[model samples]
Target: MHIADLQRLITRDPGRPRLTWYGDDGERVELSGAVLHNWVNKTVNLLVEEFDAAPGTRVLLDLPPHWRAVVWALATWRTGATLVLPPTTEGSAVVGQEQDRGVADVDVVVTSHPTSWTGTSAQLVAVPLPALARRFDGDLPPGTIDAGSAVMTYGDQIGWVEEIDPTAIAVEPALRHEDLVTWALACTPRPTASEPRTLVGEDHPLVVLRRTLQALSLDGSVIVTSVASTTAFADEPERLDRLRATERITD
Candidate 1:
């Protein structure tokens, strides 16, 4: 089961909201399957046309656990590029630091920063968050690409791309396409027709990725919150009431 296959499955239900994200600052973002797929397609075209990304290409995903991160991950997988995550140190809450040396191993690095980055020798792709705000205030660095601006010019559909191998390495830490599909299927709970199954969790890559996959696998929707927000809403009764009042969460 390649990432492309999962995307195809979700795209069949284009009208339903597949992912809803809430930022720490009360920013709300909702993407239907078709919208998500359109972003993925643009990303694929950006990586391929600009960075010459192809099968076996290594892409360093240096972004936060925002919705755009999920878009990059799926785009990388769909392009058959190996997604290399930044190294994590034990007991450290921060991830995807710019100073990390892991970027040396990849061909291109995609980051969620407003300005250009000079931390790595690899080609840079700055993917600004918030989606709507101005990307950069000054001139971008040489050899750096602004994904936010470039993606808009690309076609919304991925046309004439090569077929991706399901056995290819999709992510670092030894996760393959087939493995991800199996895991998502196993973790996805059966959803009722009345309400969509929902998951709330901290804005960390691992948590966001897993929950997003599970929701997509079961044709459900998710609500993403920051760690601080999760801590603030820890009381069980209040949390339960809030979830119930929303009338959108099944789990």
Candidate 2:
């Protein structure tokens, strides 16, 4: 299945919560299919209009498992741009590999922290992690795009989509655009689970992205905790239990 196909399925129940996030600072946010789509659409416009991203364009997502990070993934696929996560960031925690050697061909870098843009020549798009943030209040690096705030200015509906090669790599770990949905669906929950409501405690953005895909594949939902709050639910068994019960988690 393709990204558009998954999007159609999501909108089938637009109001049903698709992803729920808990931040380190005691912040909580929920995204239904409709809401998620809106964010993704806005981001798609940003990538396409700002950078002319399309098939073969490589965008490096350098943020953690925040809601904006999720939107980046969705938008990248929609644009048919290659989402070059750092091999480990590319593959690990934030789904990106770090350093100049790692991102040799990256055309754009979307990051929350741009310590020094000198490390890479890729266009920088700085994002703030806060859910309600109207903009990135921090001092932005030279030639940086405050995407967190610019996202609001972009048209919510995607202006267009590129027709990409189905065989082209859409995500890392060699996931092709055509095979992504099937790959995600293959990540089935345990046999006893039904309408799986997954709990992703890990802080890795790759883990969050993978779980999100798995939940969608299973026609399930997910509850994710941010990097700072990984231990929030774990430290309180009672609270975790209450959360599970409230969300009706099957696995």
Candidate 3:
């Protein structure tokens, strides 16, 4: 199913809770389907109508792992842009075997820092979360985005890539259950209860993980990709403890 289809489901059932944002203090903010849909709509309007973002246009997203990422990602997909994510914000040169899989080529870069653009030479724009928050009075921006386009990370810049043809993108109507089934089949190969160290790698383990969780009929699960360094020290016991403690609130 396309991202728009998923958004439509939420719009149809606005009260259904779909996302839970956890804080370091164990505080949580629940994003109900209806509320999330509205937020996405606002965000879509801001990006598309306000900024003139269109399908196949790349929009850089430099924000952290907030609920906004999820919403913006869905909106980008619906609009037909290929969403890009930078490996890190420190502006390190691409290195190691994992660099190839980190950031894909794109036309725009979104960064939190207005100065110091890094990584690619794409158009740079800063989406200051604080400024945005103040602008909206803590509410998400306004508008609905159609899938078929995507919002991805460029380098440290944020703007639009106009080379893509919006007319070529399409959104499948029934993607949820079908995607669930696909995820179930893919995640079944991993050892579920093993030490966390084994899970960290330059691999797409979550693809398989999603499949496994789906098979169990689990309604929700957070899959942490190995970007967290603590999992590498799982054998050290204390290190793993600290890492686990840090992530426990989200779990």
Candidate 4:
């Protein structure tokens, strides 16, 4: 099934918030189901009609952790396009990996940090989130196409680019237990995803505190901190400061 076709779920609940982007500046951006559907549609149009990107095209994504990255990824999937997520920051390591892995001809590169890729000599294009946002301005684009149709249209558009044979890209589909725990900690309490506190087990505050200390053991600066919470969690600001002041991480 075309995963991008998931847009159809929006019609059933147009008002439900489909995406919530928490900014580093303490700003929150919420996109309702209907709004997200429209943004993806416009994104698809721009990719196909403007950039000539289509299904099977290998697009590279080099973006920071933000809402725009989420939208761009989904939009690429919607177009049946293969996506390459480079390391968070650009450097020789990222370039060497893409080359060693034979991922040349990266059609596009969406990035917020442009200087990181200077002198890479790749066909890289910068597609920043703010710029893409200006394309729609919290409004829907003109189109009567449904989710399934969009995927088919995208597939056809890519077919004209080159006589490219269809092939599956290698990807690891499973996450290790520790990796899963790390991922779970990054999540906040939300309806769409798991509850963060659910991972807080037996030791109550102590377990979390110990885990936080363990997380710091690897990298002294690696600290667990909370944003907004009424409950007394181990990673609270006060505890983090105490740990830091005591040189718990320095050692």
Candidate 5:
């Protein structure tokens, strides 16, 4: 049987809010399973149609722990592409320099940068945070495309595609689709049915991804706050309590 974690989750509960994000700049975003699934589908189409990403294609995801990053990761797997995570400290580097290291040995690189990239030899897709209304500044390299714009042109339903091998390497360290789903399920807490859980910490992609999946696996929602906001709440517990968060997962 084919294993598709995101697809299965969306199928199970399309209307439930699976992921919620709060940024330090007071930016907030919420994604229901259906909406997240649509983004993933569009991304998968972009990878397959524009980037020629097929099964086993190496895709380097060079972005912070934001909603867009999560969407790209799921889209990579859905398209049967191998997901390559950047180094832990890569997020701190300057944009151009960071792409040099992160894009190495990968067929495609999807990044969240403000400006267009003109360096990488690999297929580059720019996913600007707080997507701009105008085109990105600077000359884009050949094969570079704005992901924010491209995804909007694709269909929400991913058409016929090859079934993904459950045991295939989805991430490093022998992590497979089945393994990822199992880990997320294990991390999930028992359902309380009263209030959603809360996740607050640094922008770590793995932790954010896992926590989001954990909440979804139990048909529960989550409120993910920035580390700064979380720290502020530490001094004012009542403020955190006012959000009605049933549980708190911290770094």
Candidate 6:
């Protein structure tokens, strides 16, 4: 359901906004269903054409609660690669616990902070979180790909598709393609997914990721916060209220 579900959502309503992101730096980006599908396709091409990612490939996602993270998730799934999400930002319980794990531990490292991966063999794809940016913010390491720019050059339509087994593991935490939507729905509790729900929240990174997937699977929209809402909105009540009203974040 991972790839097929996304295709259906984009086809059903190409112009409806699917993802609305809110960054800690006051950045906001809204991608319609078609736009979201394009990003996923381009990233899928980037992974398959540039990085040679395919089934059984393990791609590590080292990112915060951002829109690109969602894009990477869909793209990784589209390629039938295992999405390796470290339980903790540093390192935690992965399927195979390595003695010393860094960003280099996986086949590809998708992150904004690539400095942590020194002398690593994995393909580093540096991503800039800003809404409008051509490349990653500073000097990226020698071999790192500037994802912001590289993704733009890729074809908007997915050129090829891999035959994904419904039972194959698509994510690190042992989520299979057949059960991905069911698992995500369990993590995110909000308005029924059948309607146009615009959910906003501050949850764990994994939970937030799951929530985004749930929204996509169920034809809903999501607004994720870069920082926990409590922290980012602590000093700005009016800002919070305005956003809630604008996005129709009703309980």
Task: Using lDDT, give the best candidate's number.
Answer: 2
| Best-first order by lDDT | 2, 6, 1, 5, 4, 3
Report model 3's TM-score to 2 decimal places: 0.50
Residue-level error in angstroms, candidate 4, position 4: 3.7
| Superposed Cα deviation of residue 136, candidate 6 (Å) | 1.0
State the lDDT of candidate 1 residue by residue for 112-199, as single tens digits: 6524346455787877776354354355667677876788889998866657766767777577766876665565454454335575
lDDT of 6 by residue, 65-104 (tens): 7788889988988888888875574422332344344323
* lDDT score for candidate 6 against the true structure: 0.76
Report the lDDT tens digits of candidate 2 across residue range 1-251: 66677777777889988888888777889999888878888898999998998988888888888777878988888888887666443322322334544566778988887654445667889888886687887877688899867988888677877786788888864878887767666654432465578877676677677778777656677788786677777788898888889877767
Better of 2 and 4 by TM-score: 2
- Worst 10-residue stretch by lDDT in candidate 3? 139-148
Ranked by TM-score from best down, the candidates are 2, 6, 1, 5, 4, 3
Candidate 1 runs further than 4 Å off: 89-103, 114-119, 137-139, 187-196, 235-240
lDDT of 5 at 20: 71
Tens digits of per-residue lDDT, candidate 5, 104-135, equal 55778787652333454557787766622234
Q: lDDT of model 6 at residue 145?
A: 94
Candidate 1, number of clashes:
0
- Candidate 2 wrongly placed segments (more than 4 Å): 87-100, 188-194
Clashes of each: 0, 13, 39, 0, 0, 0
Which tens-of-lDDT digit does each residue in 1-251 have in candidate 4? 13333466443567755444434323446666677667666666656664566554666666544445555655665565666666444444566576665556676555554444544545444444442233222222122122222333343122233221223331112322123224333533311222111121222222332332232222111222222221233446694355346433332
Off by over 4 Å in 4: 88-98, 119-123, 129-251
**What C-alpha root-mean-square deviation, in Å, does candidate 3 show against the real structure?**
10.5
**What lDDT score goes with residue 136 in model 2?**
87
Error of 6 at 188 (Å): 4.0
Q: Compute each candidate's TM-score over C-alphas.
A: 0.82, 0.89, 0.50, 0.52, 0.78, 0.88
